[model samples]
Target: MPRQDDAGSESEHGKIPKSTFEIYRAEGDSQFRNKSFLKAIECYTQALEIKPGDQYCLVNRSKCYLNEGNIAKALADAEESLKEDAAFHKGIFQKAEVLYFKGDFENALVFYHRGHKLRPEMEEFRLGIQKAEEAINNSVGDPSVIKLRSDGDLSFFYAAEEKKKPAARSSYQKPKKEDSGPKRAQRNKAPADSKTIKKMLGDLYADREYLEKLLREESAKARKTEHSEKIQDLCIEGLNYLDSRSEFWQQQKPLYSRKKSAMREAAEKDKSSAAKYVIATLEEIDNKQTAGEHEAAIKQATRLLRTVEKWSPEDLQNREEIRANLHSLIGNSQFELERYDQALASHQADQKIGEEHELEESQARSRDNIGRVLAKQGNFSEAIQVWEQRLESSKSLSPMESTWLHHEISRCYLELKEFNKAKELAEKALSYANQMGDNQWLLNTNVLVAQCEVRLKNYASAAGNFDSALEHARIVDNALAIDAINRAIQDVNQKLVEEEKRLEEERQAGEQGEGDAKPDEAAGGEEQQQQQQQQQEQQEPVQQQQQE
Candidate 1:
């Protein structure tokens, strides 16, 4: 989770010195290597503070941001670096990559040409050119169109402890030729078997090559003879095959294009055919459940339940895309019917299926949905915990996904009576929603912000957020958002009016008490004066009686 302190920007007091570029770099690279991207962002931010256009850090750091699923930061850094040096191949390539990732394919293609022109003979740069060209041909060429959680940390995707097979039980023994010995893909990395290896030597070297090719510059420093030999070998072995066949490559393009076209057509047919029958059933159940006949919905759900139960992994993967939709329908129906156990049970069963799957993306989504169900039951803390875990595991979460996380976090903060944190997270969620252009999420975040204000005793602000929520609700055409906002607005207005009336009544009571006290003091003074007058009158009466 990003620290609450990162709410705005760096603090003025504890400012990192402007000269500490090395420290900033250390922190940035450490976090980048560890895949702790939010920290890396902070580090890069500090570095940029010291030196605005640190080209090396800016370019490398921007790529890290992209890997961290921060498209805006990546775009900003890439654009800024490119501005510094328009023909700088590294920065230009980074810009093109960011553009491609952001779905700016036409502009990305144009930049790709510019980048390629700067380093036409470079292999990696040519690959970027190839990627752009392919995007134009595919009509779906946005390379930057990353799905949420698409990037798996190398450590996560490739497990560290390989489970030994039964045949390979002997410890300290090398593998036999029959097993082909783990693909040998991480090999061919030795630098002539002479130089002591740096920890990130391979990956660093690769990145530097990528940088030089895209930057249209020579290597940063002259390499060791051994290193030169290795690079030369790679140049020969990697792109040399393409070079060897370059003469005839254009002739093969037509055949390749025909095969690709046929494959795409077949894929579309397969995709269309793979939808589940459960979708229609889910709709029918939803209507039935709405009509207060939840048993009918449950019966409808059972149609797919048994089929899903009997499905193999392949079947589930290919044909059970509607499982979530159908399950949600049934769960809603059961809840409306006052069958809490059944509703919870249905959701739990679906959660189990998600747990059974090994796909991290699917698993994160499952956890998020489970947290939603828990939230409906007012288990806000538990829901936040579930999503916090999911968010932590989720690599490369986009802005929309982050909105979901922050919105959920705000709800949990509300339940915990952390009103300030709740409001902050709600506001953060709104910002992310705007970034994602997801109106529904924006509406939800606005409504939550209103509720947070209510918790903070800020009635006027609550009313304002409620109005904002209603506006967004109208834009999104969300009945629930509209209803919730209207209710909150009315509630807040009534509360404010009542509070005003109560304060007026209290003021009037206080005035009446003061008036009563003054009269009491006057009455005491008058009684004493009257007593003195009576005494004097008695004395005078006695004197007059005496005179008479």
Candidate 2:
């Protein structure tokens, strides 16, 4: 210390003014508290230059980087801090925060638990563990609930309070020597302790056994509701404990298969009870569908189908009927979910079963479903053919059913741009709807007619039809239909205005053209006469020259 100063100037090879590491670190802490992340980073960098292995400074700067949305830099700082001190709780927590923000809740939970174990009193670590667990639960139970990265709400995982800094020293402190011996010794230990590993394995086995017992109980139950509930609970528990990497979890695979087989065997042993169970399961699927749980409905229908497939030939008292019902249920659920390809496949399977059994009603229903799918896919020509075939096959139908079929065919024709055909079918459907006095079909048929009229460029007729449709929609108290008809009316009015403007512009252009053409025709006649006189004069000159 050639000249000691208040700012802690040091001289080794040359004298220079330099603040102590504590002062720079304190400045960083102040900036960080004020939310000045860039300035905090600058101060932390200066502190690190003075004391390169300061874990506290590195961890604090990692937090600053995280606040600035620099995830990679934050992770780098956290990793370096952990390298300096492997037991650094703040560094571990920061690493977990980065993982949580990245939507790796499983790994985040691991790191958070590790940090919590090291620092039990830290509220941030505990909160992080809780959040990571919640995220993991959502991902396991319903993946759709997980927020996307672009959802702009990563602050939920970052809601922990900022950590307080340690008390600063009054004087400059020398950098401590690196400790490699202890770190190297610790590195030789196993990643997880033997006791913890054994506990994890034991817990996994216990859960698996419990699930297997539940499945057995479920198969023994005669009540379908109780049995379905038990199976559903087993599925949830299995999902909660499932881990692909664990040997214990992998061992549970055959147990799950055996449980499924047992359930199937029990159902097949009693055909009457099994039929009742199938009906109950179908009712459950329908309830799910009605509740807008389309995904759950689809899963239940698939499971029922699998169970039906496992039934013995003799045990299948109503095998064809049950299979057809399951297929139809799956198709309806998939359709509600807008999974068109899967729905189409299920409907086709149902149709084949119906055809083999010669069930006319089922066949007609399948054809209708197929036509609906085709129309949704914009294959209107094929949809029309299918609907026409259905129409031809059904000779004796209720007035409402026939009206609905005509309406369906008219919709196809409208999509295909066949306005004349659409109008004819729509009018016929309207007549049937009027005879039945059904307001809903009347509204639909009226809209179809309005659409056809718009396509035919009959704006007044289209407007009248839309008005009638709107009145019917209002009478039925269907706000959505009312809005649709209102929009149609507005569109027709817009088209009418455009047409009138176009006609007026054409009339003006024609009048201007006529006025301009009269003068042009007179000038053309005068020019023609002048050209003839000039030609005669030239010919007379030639004749005189010849006579001479």
Candidate 3:
């Protein structure tokens, strides 16, 4: 709900409050267009509660439910919507489709026939009738004999046997006994159907005419499976999409048609003709991958990984890029898995090539890799020292102080009992980090400073710092920082108790010594008084100054 501050400048609907018909209608429309079906549900549910007869809300809500495969809710919605507006064609269509999907073909056929009678030229409705008839026809087959093979042998016995067999979940393991080997071997295995049939990656282009055609077909199907409508159509609509700078939906299409056309036009005489074309296409794809372009990188990485696998490690050449990207994928996957050592190694492999080949970004990345691995191992001193050198040597922080450098180094110092240094550095990091508008990362620096204060045993100072850190971390909902603070609170409390105990012990010892003093000094008092009077005369001005 939007609130108005006693000003007419606010919209009439502003003060209508949340869950109102107008609010839900607006939000539902926006979220539906944005393809957020779950969010649209929230909005539609709101509108339906407020205005039960909102035609637009019900119809759209039905669409969201259908998309989410909630067939029951979709059926209820379609029926309820038709009750609201009997003449609505979309609702009628939805009702028929829901009935069909639910296998109530008898009622479905009746609804489809009625819909078709009203709108006869609709091919989709006609298809629905055909599907209903086909289901009715197929219903006569025996359940046990339904899956007879091409040779007319019953498959249920074999299929049931396979189902009972245990699958090998580990990628590296062999399947359990009952078996024929897999038709599509698990990842890390050779292609299950045929060793020659390698996977076509999303963007990888096959230059050979036949190979390109097959790869494009598979890629198109894959894109469709992934629900990427635009990219899927690219295989057939290559030229149309490739010509338009904005039509990136089918960018992978160019790899098939364009490369094949070029290879076909150049010479169809030899495999080398296609190989040369493939090399050219690969180079273009590699450039996009290296530039941090993600959509194409996924495609490029799979292709590159397979290409490297085809060649013996020693025989591979000039595909420094292929190796680099494979390593990048390995490193990223390992990083996600928290296999820091393996991740660092893979990152270094790529980073090493980029550096040896004079790539500055690669060198910076290598340094970042070293920092990640070292910090994970709790070698904060070296990691901090390394990043400080990098920060000093560079004219300006690369890409917003590379937040990890500042944050990781600070964490190290806090761990190593170097509180002042950590707090000072973390604060400095926040100054530069905020200017770059990386607000969350900047907030992280504040949290690090708070952590340092806690480590320094400055409890009075730390409480306020921790409060601010908690507020910011809550806004970001940063899990790591929240966990750190919970631990910090416990840690600081223990340290405070220990310090107070030590101070009280020392104070008690001083009092005990004073209480044990002897009174035998009375005899010597006369001599002592004469000496003390002389000392007092000498120290009187100093004592006065001390009193003042």
Candidate 4:
């Protein structure tokens, strides 16, 4: 075995001491533990090169790719591992995990079931099956009632092999010693037993029926656990992911429909084919924005604004919304460039269009943009006022949006040294985040609350809140957040020590001052008594002389 210290090292020959596959695998494992996923992938790749078709290295590399957000490569490696041995439990599980993350619950469930059959003792496979089932149900009601593949394959439970074996040759053609092995015998009997197949199908049908019934019940909606709702959201996310994965979905739907409608109307009026040019120009502007070419985006948006202004209301029914959006886009690009004054002017114009059109959604969005620009300009009081107005009228705001509003307002309060108000708003933001089940927002609100506590001199509470924020940050795998939280924890601890030391010094000074004052008071009383006796003696002598 390679020692931990030997990871990523080489001998005089520019190779590990043993130069064996295990050495490379061990180094990969070490790098994985350190969360250096890219480096781990490099090490695992080298290991696989040394030991081609090694199941362990392939699966490990797939996991590294998954962690690095390369789901396609991860799935490829996972399937490759399975090609080496279809019955490999780890490979099956890895493939299921990748599919699950990719939002392919049906395929994922099949692999999960396969892994469970191969390794009945593994709880992960069971959990995977349950999660995939829930996701499937959430997206489409009871699976049993849903149409299965036209072929005999029940893909949800057991995926058919992509390639089928050739039919058996005439009985006398293939008599050989190699064909007499147990593996060969198993392959010969690959089809499930009739009774077993029937039983599995019955179970799947029953599961589907139960899901259909549950979905039909009015009480079912009320009874859905928070986890189920989260699964439903995941289902929607998977759909969106699939849509984005396809080129037509990415390009044809959102932009083309509205642009084409307006362009058709405009072309009919002008008898010209300027629609394509306008569409291409708009796409170029968007591309520039996405590429972080803020200046170019702003210039393009300004030119587009002039063209849009020339279009009459007859050409575009939603002309105001379009013009407002262009202004908003320019504002956003300006904001990105830290041109707060120009951004503010653009967003104000967007708000004006919203007011003229009575578009509440656009108005709310414009107010938000304006507030953000104001905040960036250090006009936090103005920002807070704008955000508060926006919040008051936002009946349709999502929990995430509500959380943002509360959190940003609290941040403004914190900057103004209004600790109590800041803490109150932060707590409200936390509640909203909890309702949304958003760990990223949870992390943000928790940190905001901790900051409020720190400003209020609640160091202990701040420390506790910071610790909670750190846990949220870790769950989200935000390295920057984790590092910032760690530093915040350190700062809170330091403040706590300083506070204790300051209080102790003040207490000791108070005690010393009291002790000195007691002695001075007693000596002053003795001096007063002595002065009285001397005055009385002098008065008696004068009285006696007058009597004589």
Cα lDDT listed for each candidate = 0.57, 0.65, 0.53, 0.67
Ranking by lDDT: 4, 2, 1, 3
Which candidate has the top score in TM-score?
4
Q: Give the runs in model 4 whose Cα sits over 4 Å from its true position.
A: 1-308, 392-396, 413-424, 542-548
Count clashing residue pairs in model 3.
0
By lDDT, the best candidate is: 4
**Preferred candidate (lDDT higher): 1 or 4:** 4
- Stretches off by above 4 angstroms in model 3 are 1-323, 338-341, 392-395, 436-439, 477-525, 529-548
TM-score of each candidate?
0.35, 0.43, 0.38, 0.49
Separately for all candidates shown, the number of backbone clashes (residues 3 or more apart, or on different chains) is: 6, 0, 0, 1
Candidate 4, residue 82: the lDDT equals 74
Question: What value of lDDT does candidate 2 attain over all alpha carbons?
Answer: 0.65
Candidates 2 and 4 compared by lDDT, better number: 4
Give the worst 10-residue stretch by lDDT in candidate 3. Answer: 154-163
- Over the stretch 1-548, how does candidate 3's per-residue lDDT look in tens digits? 22234223446665443434676678788898887999999888877766765667777888787666565566667777767456667776777776665544546666666678878887556656655544432222111321222222211111111012122132223577976664421112111111012122223223223443653566656335533443333332332221121111111111111222221233233345334544555555644432223345445656656666676534543345445546655564454345678777877787787667664444555566667667667787777766776666555554344555676576676567677987787677666656654434444555556556655667656556556655655554444345545555555556667778988999999998776664545657878999999998999999999999
- In model 2, what are the clashing residue pairs, if there are any? none
Model 3 residue 101 CA deviation (Å) reads 29
lDDT tens digits by residue: candidate 1, 197-260: 1111333345434533532322233544655545544443332222212211211121111122
- Lowest lDDT sum, 10 consecutive residues, model 2, at 182-191
